[model samples]
Target: MSEALWQPSASVELLKQRSEIISKIRHFFYQRQVMEVDTPALSQACVSDIHLHSFCTTLSGPAAPKTMPLYLQTSPEFHMKRLLAAGSGCIYQIAKAFRNEEAGRYHNPEFTMLEWYRVGYNHFALMDEMEQLLELVLGCGSCERLSYRQAFERHLGFNPLEAEHVQFMVAAKELGVADLVAKEPERDTILQLLFSLGVEPHIAQQRPCFVYHFPASQAALAKISSTDPQVAERFELYYKGIELANGFHELTDAQEQAERFANDQAYRKVNGLAEAELDQRFLAGLAAGLPACAGVALGIDRLLMLAFGQTHIQQVQSFSIERA
Candidate 1:
């Protein structure tokens, strides 16, 4: 088959529906007094998440023909947090986020993200706000709240936290998911696999749910629960089994954050991934003082997909990589 002869496919009506949905999202947030903000898509540093791949580029400048490395942001989280630290109140951004090595029905190398922050709020408060936002945007009446432990218990009949490494391995084997757990012995990895394969599909069938209180080790940038050190103040909203957004109570402890970033760098080295440059500027913001805040990043394209009952991401995008 000739590549030129093949044409990209998507319904015009679906595209219009996507546009309406996006408009509704902006209006909803705007009504809530959330100020929309814009930041640069290119950055001097990339995210430290070992699992995510960032696209790198070089800027050609007249100053000595310098070639400094730049990256297309995977999420606007870092930059947005910097703004929040600077006293921007209740900010939101609808922006393009880029990632490498991703392309599928629900995955794209570049897609829109609806990221927002609420100053002086914790993860639980953010969860409530996200529920209302999803209800308004999707026109759903109500949503559910489920904890990570509850999800594991409800779906797999096991307490993820209490399960030993061997026990988790046994569970995976019984579930016929042994291959997925064999290479990674970490409890979080096994739990993640089971959640994706077993629990998520079931959750998607219900109304949108905010799964909160993640294990501390998986907190990423979220603050640890003061009442329960074992978990972090984090939540992820899921719909139709699709992960729509992730939110957290900001971790203001600069020293702990620095350690986490260093640990992430070490993990990257161990995994044979490129080490990302540390954004000292962002760290300096942390040192200068960051407000107690909560932030979330929603996959805008995925939200559009659920709203329009469309399964593929490329359908909603004007020019996907294949079309481009």
Candidate 2:
């Protein structure tokens, strides 16, 4: 191994800048009376999202006769929501999140996440707050907003909301990703490829761009739009072609949430992925009643990258996955 592996990935100057930016973020939320919170990084239940992978460990010692499996949280959404159910209103957390995924230019197995929830606010309201924070920290001016359909239409010359599976197949072929899609042949998979490969690159790089109203099938924890059942009230922020944040209008219906979890399980089984145990505590929180709110999870490393005009995520992190 290289001796340089012992060193931090980020420079001292960059680390100082990262600290200042986080301070600014905290101040921004403090001015709005959003309470900062802390949650456990480990949980007995893991996320059911098919696209996300959680790191697992076994708990031993006198806690139980047999070792119990636990998973590192990919995000702190569930724990924060439970707090909301218990009347902890307007909360935010700058916490470490772990994902058992490949590390790349924009991804690290472990990264910092800034998550916040605003009670009685919808996704659009949350987007407004997000834009304000970006303007304050990144000084990017006002952000542009576009519906998911509009983004696809403007960039790919087709409206994704109305497109058929065959159209996506044709588009994938046209975009030179047909081989990649052939392995999955799923509509959402193809759409994601088309978005990342075809559309994301074309989004505004100098400023934040919010893409809202994603297809219902892609909704992880968001509520389905009341006016349109085909779409969910979810939004994703992208800056410099990098996904920086994801927000959702909170879904409080326990039955709907349970069904979504089951759908994830079925998809995992079909895809030969491990079936994750359901987060019954979170579901119970929903069943007991959670306040109307919208919440978002933003990548702190990616935000720092944008602020410092850096390309690789490691440039803003103290250590990359390799060094960690």
Candidate 3:
């Protein structure tokens, strides 16, 4: 075991840089009149995504002596949506989110997230907002927009929408991605691997790029596009090949959302993963009627890295998992 002291060298210059970036982000939101909010870190329920493993703990107290399962929220999305349903227009939050089984140059189990929602806005409008936010935070004049299909075509020499499973498998092998096809035999998994390995590396480096209109199979909680039934109204922001944010056109149908969550739970059960408790409150909020809105969750640490042109996330953060 390594017993090295894990103190980080926080130079005054770098700290000042971090502060300036944070201030700029806050000012951008303030200019838009987006109300900043806070929510609980611990929750009774957690995300149902099979790919994401949340950190769970037993809550022990006089009122809860039996030790109930509490999970560190992967994102503040659900609670924020509830607030939206309650008629809070245009909200944003910069908070610490926790996830398990993530530790790397670009990842940490515990990290900061910047999430925001715009009321009565569609996915396209949100895409524009993302561009402006990037310009404001990074102090760039303009950013580029690329659809998922276009990005795949430009970088991988194939359209992601029409690619076959065999082609994706072959590409994964060429990219040296281990266990890519074995984990999930679905085409979406293969496409994701190809994007992560092949296409993502070639995105705009100096300016942020918004990749929009993802395939329907990749839509976790977003609404499917009416114009293109094959694609969902989802977009992800990438800077210099690194994914910084994921945005979605909010899905308002409670029944359909519940069905999707059930499907995710079933997938988890089949894969021998722990089941996530359903967030009945969120479902209730949806049933009560949520406005037409779009929201996004951005990686604050990754943004910091981009702002400073840092190679690794550990450079900006006070302490990483290895150091801890």
Compared with the true structure, all predictions reach lDDT values of 0.85, 0.92, 0.86
- Ten consecutive residues with minimal summed lDDT in candidate 1? 1-10
TM-score of each: 0.94, 0.97, 0.93
The digit string of per-residue lDDT tens for model 1 on 1-324 reads: 557535554576777877787888889888989999999999998888777888998888784287888889999988988888888888999999999975998888989999999998888888888878887778876788888889888987877767777767777887788887888856777788888877888895768888889899999999999998988999998888688998899898888999999999998888787888887877888887888999999999898888778888887787677776
TM-score of 1: 0.94
**In candidate 3, what are the lDDT values of residues 1-324, reduced to their tens digit?**
555444652345776888888888889999999999999998898888888888888988996988899889999999999999999999999999998976887889988899999999998898888888777778776778889999888887777788876666667777887465756677777888788878888887777788899998888889999889889999998888688999999999999999999999988888798888888898999999889999999999898888887888878877777766
In model 3, pairs of residues that clash are none
Question: Which tens-of-lDDT digit does each residue in 1-324 have in candidate 2?
Answer: 999999999999889989998999999999999999999999999999988999999999999569999999999999999999999989999999999989999999999999999999999999999999999988899999999999999888888877877777777888887778777767788788899988899897767899999999888899999999989999999988889999999899999999999999998999899999889999999999999999999999999988898999999999898898
Deviating ranges (above 4 Å) for candidate 1:
1-9
Off by over 4 Å in 3: 1-6, 173-184
Which lDDT value does model 2 have at 193?
Answer: 84
Which residue pairs of candidate 1 clash?
204-240, 204-241
The TM-score, computed over Cα atoms with residue i paired to residue i, of candidate 2 is 0.97
Error of 2 at 307 (Å): 0.7
